[model samples]
Target chain A: MKAFQSVAVIGLGSMGLGMARSLMRGGHEVRGCDLARDALEKLAAAGGSAFNTPAAAAHDADVVVVVVVNAAQTRAVLFGPDGAAEAMKPGSVIISSATMSPVEAQEFAARAGEHGVLYLDAPISGGSARADAGELTVMASGSPEAFSAAQPALDAMAQTVYSLGEDVGVGSSFKIVNQLLAGVHIAAACEAITFAKRLGLDISKVFEVISKSAGNSWMFENRIPHVLEGDYAPHSAVAIFTKDLGIVSELGRKQSFPLPVASAALQLFLMTEAAGMGQDDDSSVARLLAQIAGLELPGMERSN
Target chain B: MKAFQSVAVIGLGSMGLGMARSLMRGGHEVRGCDLARDALEKLAAAGGSAFNTPAAAAHDADVVVVVVVNAAQTRAVLFGPDGAAEAMKPGSVIISSATMSPVEAQEFAARAGEHGVLYLDAPISGGSARADAGELTVMASGSPEAFSAAQPALDAMAQTVYSLGEDVGVGSSFKIVNQLLAGVHIAAACEAITFAKRLGLDISKVFEVISKSAGNSWMFENRIPHVLEGDYAPHSAVAIFTKDLGIVSELGRKQSFPLPVASAALQLFLMTEAAGMGQDDDSSVARLLAQIAGLELPGMERSN
Candidate 1:
């Protein structure tokens, strides 16, 4: 028999909303909370109940899924005024799904443990589409009891849940390492494409050639199409890297690890954000490079 | 009809030796030369004629493929004392396959043109294995006459020959862009894996996850196994990226293009080289990071 528990989903953004629907699809009762009334309405239309705040949603929930942006937002959702943790049942599991530092995850886990709540450090990847399909890859670490408590919700929302270690912070560490590479690859892709344009090579042909060449990366293959078509629409925004690579930079500083490559990528993201393309597609780092070089990329001749 | 030209492969390194054998397979007469007597003997054993000097090999050959190390070696091979260009017929083609700056390529093309020799700025990729199989990727640029002259050799040695532009230097420019991304991705992969080690996650499991995640790169997938196995044998050495990214940095400086990410990668490669692993596999950058962070990567607990 499948024991379907009541789940509270905080933050009804793209990933969060998809995760909430997946939980509902898994036959769990979902109570969702977000600042946007329209997002709440969308959840209601999808047969899930919606509340105005996280605490209201956390009430009576057996597992609370926190899918906010960073450690601060997560802290706000759980411990701010009328925060969910104050209202969450003592034995409920809190699945934290923010891309944050391991130290932050550790701190949060300790705070949650004080309330007799199980905290699972679970950071998700595979993007929004995978979330919709309940196929997100979750890098998670927690106690055996926390994993046991969160297994059903993990099963519903993730295709793969990597039980990284018994410690609460290891998942965040793994996720940061993943983010470090991801940010660097995106920046490298942008640098290559823009540099190709400067060299008078056809950017599209360069893409095709490099896709088959050892120069290719997952980000290069996925993100360069946006450059080829001059699509600046944010499938994933420049600000996203600015945020994620910012966390990477922060962690590197705290750890005293010299992250020359990832830090360079982070600065480029910061530069792209400063140029006012923060909300544009992450590939807009190419646009920034093109702009700086006074070269025109495809479709946007006036951009230079 | 296949034009069976007499092809001289100068500098019969692994790549050159492979091209020599491949030319023989294409029904061309192959004359090879190298400083390494064993390499020359390998060509001789493969039914190709071998010479101790490039000039001797180039004599009476219709196409001279210069598969040398850099612009300086390529210059010496083509125009040094009793050089191949001086020995070759006026109308014969010179396919220069060195990773050089565009300026250097243009200078060589101009020099070759004075001798009535058509020069193709052709830099090869796909490594020794691909070279052995006659499936390398050649990013080439030259005049139409140069293309027409070198097409047989190109067809024999390369699975794909990208005719980047009509100008001689453009091919070098394109190759530099590709190299820039390739080097950065390698360094980024090293940074990521070492960071994963610092995080206390299973490095092999991190590899398995990131290979499927968006963080993956061609270098990451192709090179991390070396780190996992603690094998640092030079499949592609750290020195290769140092040279390549050095060219990229030079090109960026000449063009006033900011390559912060690539430059960061270049520094990491330089650091890895400085640490006395210059001849080791480029994945040795991970070993360097592991050393700095005092973390033990898989397959070597004593390394820490």
Candidate 2:
């Protein structure tokens, strides 16, 4: 596959910045842009150009990757006044790497297509660490031409790219499905850990035992350590799941499908957000459970 | 560990039968009992004596293991007419392998103490396959002497024995916590997969993506195959989670702790059981979700 020689990465947040560095490392002339000046400066210091607007970044790019927070931000970056889609060349691809609904993804793809740009419905996973390491997993689907155009950036930014199909919405559908389970498992992990604390078992011991047992999940193994260490610093914040699972809930409602587990998990994230821990690590939900139950977790002072 | 020379295995169901064989394999003279004649005959063929009653099996045995369905059956086997506790010799140990509440386990331990018998609150996990392989994980708690008396059988039947504490109820508490997550995860797996189907994504592809993604749990990896192949034959049945998560809900209520995710999962299992899939594989909850959404899952005919 021929590598895109010039790439634009919009929304230089944790994930986007890491991906921008990865693209630069993969021999692309990368241009980065974000609302945060500090993030843009970091990208500039890493030998890539930084821009104040998506349009400035995408003006001469072979590929424009929109890695924003949600569908609205994605749309704003792509089609807002002086948007990247307007600035980019016709044959260039726009890789949309936001967790959103399939319908929203299809809408974005159609809008990009109208601008004579190829669109790849790509949603990334594996967190910021893997993103920085060029090892994220990308669930991607779009036209063959879009895939061909985005191949270099995808190869640089992802360790595995699941080519879902030619359908524009398929990648987002898979991502929403994944978010459904990830959100639920995180809630379940928090519930289990705090429930063990309520039951008077040593929370660390419970973690050790459960991680080796049938009750273990990816979230449990990954997030329980934050609880054990009493570190609520956000690797992935509680608000993220609230947003992602909210998307799942919205889509489920639109499809008339009952997503009771996802809905239940979404409530936990909402509760965590309501408790003022939205910006903390998602594992802070365990502390929220401990607080409601009137129990003290390791490293957490009683909030009341 | 001094191996108990004479052991009685009451309740020769899947888990009990496997433990009985493991004990016999460990060079113990095992006496087995079950209501099912087929289970009894299988035990007898394995060179263990099979009895029609718990007391008959416990008579002259140094250790009696009650591996029944729940606390009710555990109580029946230990204290009912012709009970094993009455038949077991003084100073012998009664190892309870059933999953129940901490309160129930404490009560059982006290009653065993009244009979001048050592009691070990040991609730086994790792399923029947692990049990048959002598590789189950046991969450155990009891007195020093009780641990000493149960060590031989514990070694024979389990790969990992988590000595939670000397407190009689500690093991059961840990087991309940494990069950809380296990049940929720299985339900979440069902919810996520069926929701994918409802969204019109390929279910098998969803399974492939999820198992490799952060959405995965031990339950998801182990049980999603049942959904993928449309084979719902019981590796573990729906009624199992109904009972296990019921214990979690009951315990949570008693503790005034809100287990919202687990509660939601419990409702799913209850619905699955109410729909007459109680004896089907636990993954059949996926079928229930598909039915509710009017979606067809692989291997499941549309019930409507």
- Measured by TM-score, the strongest candidate is 2
True lDDT of residue B242, candidate 2: 95
lDDT of 1 by residue, B43-108 (tens): 999999988788899999899999988999999999898789888888789999989998999999
lDDT digits (tens) for residues B10-120 of candidate 2: 999889989988998888999988899999999999999988899999998888999999999999989999899888889999999899999999999999888999999
Compute the lDDT of residue A188 as modeled in candidate 1: 92
lDDT of 1 at B259: 89
DockQ of all predictions against the true structure, Cα-based: 0.77, 0.89
Candidate 1 residue A162 Cα shift, in angstroms, is 2.3
Report how far off residue A105 is in candidate 2 (Å): 0.8
lDDT of each: 0.90, 0.91
Cα deviation of B18 in candidate 1 (Å)?
2.3
Runs in model 1 deviating more than 4 A are A1-3, A299-304, B1-3, B298-304
Give the per-residue lDDT digits (tens) of candidate 1, residues A1-304: 2379899999999999999999999999999999989989999999999999889999989999999889999999998998999898888899999999999999999999888899999999988889999999999999998999999999999999888878988889888888999999999999989988887788888898889889999999999999999899888888889999999888888877888998889899999999999999999999999888888887677732
Q: List the residue pairs that clash in candidate 1.
A: none
lDDT of 1 at B116: 88
lDDT of 2 at A278: 95
